[model samples]
Target: MKLRKKVDKVLGTALAIIMGVMVINVLWQVFTRFAMDTPSSFTDELARYLMIWVGVLGAAYISGKRLHVAIDLLPSRLNKKGQTKLKVVINWIIIVFCLAALVIGGLRLVYITFTLKQSSPALQIPLAVVYAIIPISGILMIYYKLSDIINKQL
Candidate 1:
């Protein structure tokens, strides 16, 4: 639980910083484009990359808080015990999906990009680095789900 809290705090702080930088980057891009008559290619690309990171990390943070989207129709109709069992089942499904799709697929993507030495056109940064967030977030989500189950049992 302590580790989960720490991870959430760190990721949240990083997300905030990324969002701030994205805002500033957009403003600067606009200023340079209209006023200076020279659009900043770097800022646009950087903002997009930052946004991607923010989105993935933010999703993981939200997952930790159990705030992600869910269908409540069936649960709403169930009794307390039934609802609890349904929740555990749902959490297991989520864990399995995260492991197979996000973790495994994302790692394959990272490997492919890294092996090819692919780089972004504008930033010239390795594409693998950007793709790395997928597995990282997936792992974080797994951690959060496991923690939730443990906490519920305790």
Candidate 2:
């Protein structure tokens, strides 16, 4: 729990910064587009990339907080022991399928980005840098899932 809290704190701070930067970029883009004669082409692209990072990092925070959505129809009516067992099974399924897919898919995205030497049209920033968030988020999600299993089931 302590460690989870710490991870949340760190990720929360990072999310804040990323969101702030994204907002700033958007604001600048808006200002430049409307108020000034020339708008920055790169600002929009940069904001988009930052938004993806924000989403990925935010997911990690959600996982750490155990705030991910779960259906309550059955578990809410089940006995305590049954509920526990069901919850364990559901969580394991999530850990095995969802997290594993994230890892595999995310890594493939990173690899493709690297292989193509992809870059944003306006910003010229490496797309791989942005795509790297996928696997990193997957790892964080896995860590949080394991922690939840230990705290709740083990």
Candidate 3:
């Protein structure tokens, strides 16, 4: 429980910081394009990358909070024990999906990008770095799912 709280705090702080930077970057982009009559070359790419981080990390954060959208009908219909069993099964499903799709697939993608030395044109930042959030978020989600199972909550 304490670990989960700490992880939540760190992840939340990171996402907030990324969002702030993205907002500032986009604002600068808009100001430069229209107000200054010149666009900032790197701001667009930076914002895009930041958005990827936010979206992926945000998903993990939401999972930790058990705030992911879900139909409550089934669980609501069940008794307390049934609901808990269902939640455990669902958490296991989520863990498996994240492990297979996000962790494995994302790692493949990151490996390919790093191997190829792929980078964004404008930002010149490695795509591997940008794609790192996929596996990171996957790991976080797995942790949350496991925690949910151990705690008998979703």
The models' CA-based lDDT, in order, is: 0.90, 0.83, 0.93
Model 3 Cα lDDT, one tens digit per residue, 22-109: 9999999999999999899999889988988999999999999988899899999999888988988888899999999999999999
Give candidate 2 misplaced runs (Cα > 4 Å).
none
Please, what are the lDDT tens digits per residue for candidate 2 over residues 1-154?
8888888888899999999898889999999999996998899889888988988788878877778776789988999998888877876886776566777888888889899999888878788888988888888888887887888832
User: Which candidate model has the greater lDDT, 2 or 3?
Assistant: 3
What is the Cα-based lDDT of residue 101 in candidate 2? Answer: 78
Specify the poorest-scoring 10-residue window by lDDT in model 2: 91-100
**Ordered list by TM-score, greatest first:** 3, 1, 2
Candidate number that wins on TM-score, 1 or 3: 3
Best by lDDT: 3
The alpha-carbon deviation from the true structure for residue 48 of candidate 1, after best TM-score superposition, in angstroms, is 1.5
- Model 1 pairs whose backbones collide: none
TM-score per candidate = 0.95, 0.92, 0.97
Evaluate residue 151 in candidate 3 and report its C-alpha lDDT on the 0 to 100 scale.
81
